[model samples]
Target: MSYSTLPRIPSGWSQSDSQASTSPVSPEEGVVQSVIKIPSTTYLGVESTVAPTPQFERNTADLTSNERAALLASSSSAVAGSAADAPDQWAWRDVGCEARTLGRLSAPITLAASLQILNILVPGMVLGRLGTDAIAASALAMSVASFSAAAPLIGLLSALDTLCSQAATGSSRPGLPGIYLQRCLLLCIASFIPSVILWWNIHPIFIYLRQDPVIAAMAAHYLRYVTFSLFFTLAFESIKKFFIAQGFHHAISLVQVLGTPITLASVYFLAVHPATSIGYVGIPASVAISYALSSLMAFAWLKTYGGSRGWTGLSWEAFRGWGRMARLAVPGAVMVSSEIVALDLLTVATSYLGPTALAAQAIVSMTIQSSGTLLMGLSAVTANRVGNLLGLAQPHRARNAATAALGCGTIVGIVLGVILYSLRGQWSYIFNPDPEVHAIVKRMIPLLASLLALTVITALSLGILRGQGRPKIGAYMNLASFYLVAAPVGFLTLRYTSMGIVGLWLSFFMAVLTSGLGQLVFLLRTNWYDQVLKCEARLAHDGHHEGLMTPENHPSA
Candidate 1:
């Protein structure tokens, strides 16, 4: 088992004891590589060699043409063994493979992000045209929607980032991805119940919180019109994850691109046309219609052009995996909700400062969100890459993927920070024309830039955690950093100090920094081998009894 003597497993291929000494082959050889197995342990520091299962070898040739192409692309480098044995021997050292994987995942997501930003911006712009009352109402409505409905739903749906990516690489079953999508749909629909109730009663809730009665009533009306689109939005999210997990990233971009103009047109028409009864509520209604159309298009694409290999059609099997899905979904929901709630709390605190302060905060917040889209795309890349490696039972490669993602995040953060810093004084002009708001935004730019860098790190870490099936860890970190650390500092600074809005943003900066550091530590300390085992256990518990390379199935056993 010396490092030099160890066989070179092709990039996407795995090897067992018998194959450990096999020489690397060219892609032309068409060798059907088996899944690699970690050496079994009989006692502390004692290893047992296991032969490859004949069944696995026999089934290798059954891989689909696309699967074969994927393997070939990845096989350009030798697979690295466990990090415990040789930490520096990871396969991601192949700069080509790393770049190809990262680039492939990042490109489409970045494009899709433009559409997402447009989705946010168009509504705000349309409302701004109607008057300050409309602008205030739309802002409040969006905040409430994010906190009460969208964040939780997005969090819950995030579980698919783990389930679908792992299943894509780990399971031999073709129907697993579709089944997971079904489960996600069911979970989202169930969660939508509470969201509906919250949106329906949001007016009273906002009033009770002492928000402006006029804005509260207007926002409530907006939510009422938009509530019908919740299920469609969640469905689109689920389908998007399905595509991303399977390396169909461009399809998502296409869907978003096609939907964006429709979104813009619908919003413009509804908001400007006097004949429309919707009025201010038309902004959300247009958003709803856009989501529905986008989701339908995505579904149609999935069924037709996109590989429907994993989709076995509707089944009762979707209803069967609730327990396991919840293990990831619940924590994911909390992690997402915590962050959104923290931002909303900051919004509330700023409101107390006056309309000018609130307007300034919105411009800054929107800018940060827009600039962070590239990093969010990178986060999705990290989740898929890490999950795929773990699924292949390659802990060292998974670790490398996580490291690469963090490095990428840092580099991207620095670039974005520089851009934000350079544009600090002028960026807010795109959102608001008020000179007072611009002044406050100028004062906040330094803090906002710093927060942007920190957020990029935190977001990527959370993605890594999700990929590793450790959403609960992210949840705990968010709770501590945001609620325990950031919120208190923000409240004290806002109330007891002269820092004003700058103080609130500084607290946010501190919270994001804390979260990023916490996640980085957790990632460094992770037992990736244990994670491999956990993935196996999850696959087994889900009754996917095929394609697993467990210790019990080792030849030594």
Candidate 2:
């Protein structure tokens, strides 16, 4: 069992000679021992003496139990270590990791979205109780304010989504998110000037665009109150992104949850109270107050909680990154605005069809928007994960994250499509009691299903692109799909065919499909190693000196 007890070699051969014979030798005879020679007869009738090289011994009986155990354990550990260190290949192997990561990121985001939707819907609900005319005015005001003010501002501020997420993962500075927040706040304040002018002149603009004079005037009145909340709303949005990038998504959800009741109560008191002369303006004013409160609460949490580690306080450092931020913000705003414009145009097209068709469109639009909240949550998760991976210089994992996001989005889309398809007959009734509108919705079920699926995929793709710091690509795609393709198709179909709402839905579906497919192709063809280098360069430029940390140097690597 032990080496000392092994049988001794023959008298003429030493231990070294035996060991040499057991080991492999070259073709030359220098390393061979003469004692191991063998006589051989050649095939050509020539007799010769040749030495046969001995095969290495497979038997391990010469070694002790302890030595054998040690060798086996070391070999096993080496194999496991290599496997652990190996880069992920393009495959569906890591579904569990992907699913878990997506779930962790999605839950809070979805909850926050639900609360946000409640904030908007509560005001509308409260205003509906005032009177038919009041409800109509409120609706007009919401539409105009959303398209003219909310959409552009939200779009512009979206730049922080990329910057903060990337900065959190990529920047060496602890206060990057705070700096981003400060920069965005400055931008929002500057934007407020033009927004004020637009809100002030909305009545004339709406009239010139052939809106009902009474509704236009009422909407202008509504915006005047809501305009005060603009900066606060933008501030809330910026801070929300700041929290999200720092992996503090739960805090945002909590803030929104806490703010919802305040919003509802404010709206009720202002709109329904007899002594209050706020009237329809109270709805927007309540919204503004709710937003401002949410921002303050989130800010308080950031300061009191450990989130303030990133807060260096107001400094000139906040102004240093305006150019980089603008480069992204402007294109992001355009990208978001293009999509909004397309939807608005679709709404316009629906209007010409009749009130019934327009009503049906509204129901479908609300349903689609609600369903899209889930995708939006997933998209935020995707961006954050991808940005984090890229920041760590793990391109393979980043690729894996992106592909996994697409897969998860696809699975979610399919499930959603199936559920929506099954409920298509009765779903519209939740939004509209009318049988005719339900019928139109029932008829458009297939288009709705397709649109939902496409929307999920496109949203995930856009998120990945944003995380990669390539929002311009998304902007260009939006421009091409919405303007060059969907718009023209929508116009031609509506003008020449009796397809009505179906035609408009089809056009939007095509646009989404085009964008999604284009992004997928780009993702597949991307040289991720190059992206890793670019990510490193970005981080370096932003004052992060931890340039290109390899697997050996990275803590997680």
Candidate 3:
């Protein structure tokens, strides 16, 4: 029935564009907006509300420019108050718009992320040329570095996905994003010190864990050398996150372009060149120098072009939000690290399988790592999209962006899976010369290829959870999946039967399915509007109350 003939208005019906254009509308309300009151969550998720008034009060602070646009767009209510309800039924045009945006965003990130992988892969190649044992040691070190340093660093900074993206999008306060950046950087640096010490003294720990003594000694040495480089790596990552939050990532790509070649050249010169052949130590040293240089370049770019992004200068206020940020950061790290941690633990266990098996497992694991990190490019984009839209209180658009990310993830997974599958025989050659390693990797490649889509889905879903400020959900899900289901299945399959490394990869199918499908289902149940409320509540609690993000002077605002 027509709106004119309707007896009473429906709660969530959206008016058509023609009807909206012909009718009078309020700036504060939509063309045919809801008279129904917002169900309050009251200071995050405290949940207390009164009877709906004939007219309800709305906060002006929550009415950012984006919120105003969302209100105007509410003319199409089939999309309706269902924002927090489901992850489907988005307009085709909106999906196309988001896909185009995601494509453009993915370019710089994909380049940067691929270059980051090169820093890991090229070093392994350098080690491969040294010897089989050397390549095996390098793999062990890489796995250790992943969970010990890289995972924690990435996790701590994951909060930037939520805070910086929201601050950049929803707040008039430009410096707000930078404030969150500063806070995350501080936490990461603090976390790094303990990790450095652990690496320095890891020989005994590795021995205690029953790793091969010689390989453990070598891996321990690598971590110690790598520790010095990690600081610079941290610096580069911190600055890049700031760039990402602002949606300007060309600079990060540029830094990677310069940094990748320099890293590779240094690896060759220091490891292979007769003049400075430092043997094994050269690999870590080159990585150190490369990161230091890249960090400097990224910082320089931020200083010159960052004014528009709201980082006026560092403030003492950056010290205040430690508690608020950590709540997310710790979970973010857990969520991001859970799978990596599981794999690393498996890598540790693989040491018992002998050097050849260890080497083969490393190659396959590296192949998987490369694909997963590459997908991180898209994951980062998805996180930014969801966070920004939510900050504007545009739940419908946020939901749409999320669904769009999943679609993009599928396409990317298919393309990458094809490439990996096609390269199954020769792919391990890049990391090692051993015919045995190549054969093992070739065997595992099919299984790895099958997991590509699932990995992409999990990565994107985690990003969405991060953006939603519900990272702990992913952390919980991943921990349960990895420790409870996947790891047990893998260890039992490998030990009880003679399936070997193939069994290990086969076991991962459970982890992927458990976490991926679980997160996907949970995303369907998300209350998008409630998420918006939580975002605002978090910002007000952390950014506004602390007087760090907004331009206004009063601490009491």
Candidate 4:
């Protein structure tokens, strides 16, 4: 509820007048954030020698990935402090190295993220056996659940993305990461109340929205039964962040690798089998159980072998930072949930086209969900890699890395597009045996493929902004693209025209295009040399000399 007047730098970023006289960060001043999220990236960028800018003093916990990266990058010039350590000056090989580094870090993060998504996808696949209505109904249930559950979780926990990693730098306050972990876990629980209430009685809302009463009722039933997984999944993610914050980035990947088979098998026994199956209800029940088991195993690790970096057990003090966290968390959520809501509304809108079209939307959405999560993981790595490059004051390399990240993300997107296209014939069958869903999915493949590529490019574009410590720009772009552009396009295209489900995706395409091109042009015009100075200014103002930079803490990847 409190606000203050902060000075503005000539570059338009807020700064403090006092930092105008602060000294530049020396090479040995502080440690850089090592490791990647869930997997660490190799340091390979260089520094700039411009005069330092004045950075504002603020709460480190409230900063996003780019600012945190700037602060850390300014604190240490270790990666490219010498020409010997510098990446081969200005070669295409530089681009290749950046791509490879991004790829290596991206694999584990993508795999683990995909494994978690299987909890949603596998259920849809199993329930698809129950016919098209099941897919349509489950889609509705999940659309609401995602808004209520997944979106909110993403927002509140996004603070931890910056918070825990910043806390772990140099192990200065190991216990702070633990406190953050506890705070995030507690916050997720406290915030789920509204979502749970809505899920418990969402049928009326759906009915009022003109959703088929039968699908609404089925969706409502599935949500009511599957609600148990919400707490466990949130806990699993929080604990995963805890491990990542302390440098055990591989822990969650191990859990996911072990959990995937259990998830697949659970769906078979609890929902798919003729004798053991408990019909539609069993599909979601199995998902809940898989999530529960994953959470339990993650917690067990924390109890037995985890917490070595900074944990000293839970503290009551964590309860106090909700307001501070909320200030950061809510905006992060709004940025993320806007996209989620837009995407879900597309699905919800498709419901009016009947079970056949709704079923197709389900397949398309889930397919994209799993694939898109992978690209999203890649985007996280892009942000961190750029941040690290900036930390070394490597404007040239940071720019190159940013370019390389776009190239890498595009290639991955194209490949996923190919995969989505190639499997267009068979992909729908993975979720449903119906030929009708298959036909609709096939028609949508071309648009879906293009959307995939655009999505990655756009995501990587924003990742550069994040690395540059300017997430608000990306947030604003997202808000405008999704709300002002996509919303009207989608509504009119769907309601006024006969494009059917493809119109929904068309709107998504326009949104990503608008946001992506906007960010791309901005990054191209940016002054990288000044960005390094800004990084130094950020750390100077944050006032940390020996931060807790650890191997485990990075961004959300």
Candidate 5:
């Protein structure tokens, strides 16, 4: 509320005038005025000899006392010294490269990350030994299981990711821990609906597929086990997202590393042990056990790290606080679910082509799906960063973060595509040993390789849109691409043209490409930055500062 004037100095200042002046300005002397806010103070400096820039003066008027002090500390003569001496403090620069820089980093991160998840597919190697039909059945089971578990959970986790990231960025909001716990409950409850549907409808679905009774029976068994595992699956996912939003990627990765060996061991024991009646049941059983173990690990990590701090108490009121959370989450859920649903529909289409085609489709899709973890991981990080920036009332930074994520995804996608293409021959063996399936897969590899590259681009762009909180836009884009463009295009080519299964794969590529392109266009056309800024402004007006970044006056265009 107060203002100040500078001491007497020449209107048109020169260094030599200062040298002859009775009170010479020392090079190392301080000239900034410190502004005080409750419990925090900030300083701003003015040049005694020159008119201040409009932006600089505006920043002075806009920032609180603490923000001003922080800015002054950044620009002062001893700024570096002060920074080095102070405890690690939050700064815009410390948020790192929001857009371009992050995108560059995400490329290698995506490729290497794909390998880490691909390691999870070694279990399929054991299953592939059970003949082409068995391998086909196994692949179908995994697809169904992953979709059922991931669809409901991804949305809840995405919301958690947004909330936790905002809190970490200094929202000064109480009840973060409470909000996290309640969401965990909501996710668990929501997951049960899908679990029940998969379990109850498995028999009817297999009938629709005209599966041989034996194959149908085996798939149903697998579904039952997978259904049981959904609870743990949801739990593990929620905890992982919670940590990831807090920038704790290593913990989740570590748990996956530890759980992998247990998974392999369980799969081996189930396949070989005569005493065990489950036979192939070991696959889903191993999955179930692994989820339990991983969830427990995540819970322990959360308690040790987050529980010790302010995130201890549980409160249901956190759930009641925001209709916005639910609104954001619903479309997010739909966008992620659409991807899974599209794959399931593809499975249904492939079923009509016989077991060989189904096995081939399963392997290719599963391999592509495994690469999805990398996309999801990078996307999750991007969304969290974007949401946090918006929370802090920094729309430009939020947009930059989203852009960076897409760039990272592009590099990752291309590299992964090349790797998949190069290993096309070897990858067939990972699915099954049947000569027909292997031969068909090898023939299809080239087309699939091309698809992978394009798919990566599409997937990454989807990540960018989701991160921007336009999940509904992404959902619509997917619907248009998959149903209107990709599916119809592929079906016609496969039935009428000689492309066959290969045509189907090509369609998959086209659908994703259309969806990605559309989403990217939306990002460009819509003033998402302004949307984010406006949301921040509305929240401030409503006195909804809880779980948000430090408040700032909304900027006028």
Candidate 6:
């Protein structure tokens, strides 16, 4: 849809084209031309909204003349006979565009939180039909399945978030789409084998944990279904991240919502049926079907409502660049993988406490994981925004934006903590109505809430570092935090004290808090803003000196 055109600027605006056309286009041509020069005053507030509709909106209060000039020059291209040409420049009209951009990107976070909220009810439903042991097995299955799928691919998907956002703000280039698609395909292929192996072996692992062989066998069957579904899930996750970073998240959320009711029904029918009764297998089956439906739904939605004939080409050359992108993505995956492993290790600690404790811990962990959805969402936003700033060669603003995002994320996390804490008693009804499990969950709620803020800070810092193309920090931080801090705490406390599962939970909280604090300190100490400038400068120097990249080729080092 065409919006109103920008008004011609009289004082500061200058036409840069040498061959000026005499006549403007007709209405039939569907084009409008107008040049609006971005003043030096506006550049400082460039980080603010393009439109200051919100009270918190501020202009970019720190944009330099060079950046302002580049933006102004870019506006001329917007008027070069196509409304679709560089619509990003139109964002300048809002004056609060940056803030609005941040707000716009939050759609996925909210959606993801809502989805997690729905999953919280799963344990509750299962608790009524299956016993505590069954619930425990299911939880363990989820941890394993999630690790195989979500944890390993986080870096790859997250890279899409950062890179896509950067691509949006900058000029497009040849092979960009191919690179993204290749990366996605590669992730899909790589994720399959581990997922399959985990699916096949998870039951035996649980059996070795001394869980009931029956529950383990059933859980393994369910996990196999989940494993099969993971291929679709990972693809959907990759596409979701890619589109979200490109400022399109609403569709993914819609697909998720649309699939939820069906999934719930599937679980209920499969678990309770006379002939098809699969017991715990029903849960995994429902989850797998849900993901598959959602993936298909997401794909269909994108195809019909999104672009026609999207990403239909092959780029063999881009495959060579996978090593570089994977280099960046691996650290992020490792960082995420380590944290998940810590959480799983804590689960292992709770295993010694018996079925009731394990069931209680699983329920509580699910809730906590659900609550952290907002943190993950904010982290994604921070990564994308920071990456854009770095890509545009504005590191100071990137730092400031990262800082602001952290502040915002922290406040959100605190509020979520309060909400989750208040509802602790109520949450126990989801898995099983057992009084003992309820009591345990209620006691742990406060600790989880207290640690919520810290989780946000840690996640945001990870996002910042990852977006800054320093996934190595994320990897190292996770190693230090989980292996160095969280793991030892879990083992020592569980082994040496009578705290039992509570001790493990406490250690979990301590790990996140300590890790978050450490990440924050590291992030603050780093000169990332200066690093951005240096990167841009180095890229420019390399281009000028070595003739490896030209202005028309790419806007990168």
lDDT of 5 by residue, 293-393 (tens): 87888777767754432254666655564565666566777777776767776776777788888888777776777777666767766665565445443
TM-score of 5: 0.76
lDDT, residue 29, model 1: 31
Whole-model Cα lDDT of every candidate shown, in order: 0.71, 0.65, 0.72, 0.65, 0.58, 0.59
Please identify which of the two predictions, 1 or 4, would achieve the higher TM-score against the true structure. 1
Steric clash pairs (candidate 1): 11-75, 14-36
Candidate 6, residue 503: how far the Cα is off, in Å: 1.0
Q: Mind giving the per-residue lDDT tens digits that candidate 2 earns over 367-442?
A: 6656655565677668767776565444555676787788878887888898889998787665556688779999
> Residue 109 in model 4: shift from native, Å?
2.4
Per-residue CA lDDT of model 6 for 1-557, tens digit only, reads: 12222222122222222113223323332222322111111222232112222221222122212122222112222112211123243333232333444555566557765765565476346644578767776776777766666567655566665555444333224235335656655865776676687678776678777867866776677677666556665666676665554444566667767777877787778776668767767766676777777777876765676552124356665456566566667777787777877777677667667777888888777766766555676677677777665555444456556666676677777887788778886977766788988888888878887877567777878888867767777788788877777778878887788877777777777777777777787786765423443333322321232211213233221
Over 4 Å off, model 4: 1-79, 82-95, 114-120, 302-307, 383-403, 462-470, 522-557
lDDT of 4 by residue, 1-557 (tens): 11111111134432233124233333343422221111122221333222112231123223323223333333222323221223344566656765665555556767787776776677777778787777788888878888777776765665555455434442234476677778777787788888888888888898889888888888899898768766666676666655544444456677877777878888888788888987787876776777678778876776676534457777896787677556546655665676777889888788888888988899888877776666555665566556555554445657777877888777778887887788777777888887887888989998998888788788778667756666566677788999999999999998899998988889988998898887787887786645655554443322243321322232221
TM-score of each: 0.84, 0.77, 0.82, 0.78, 0.76, 0.76
Residue 118 shift from truth in candidate 6, angstroms:
0.6
Residues 363-477, candidate 3: write the lDDT tens digits: 7777777777677667777887788766645566677788888888888888888888998878989988889878888888878888886788889999999889899999999
User: How good is model 3 by TM-score?
Assistant: 0.82
lDDT, model 3:
0.72
Candidate 1 lDDT score at position 71: 21
RMSD (Å) of each candidate, 1 decimal: 8.0, 17.2, 8.8, 9.0, 11.4, 11.5
Model 2 / residue 323 / CA error / Å: 1.6
Candidate with better lDDT, 5 vs 6: 6
Consecutive 10-residue window with the lowest summed lDDT within model 6: 34-43
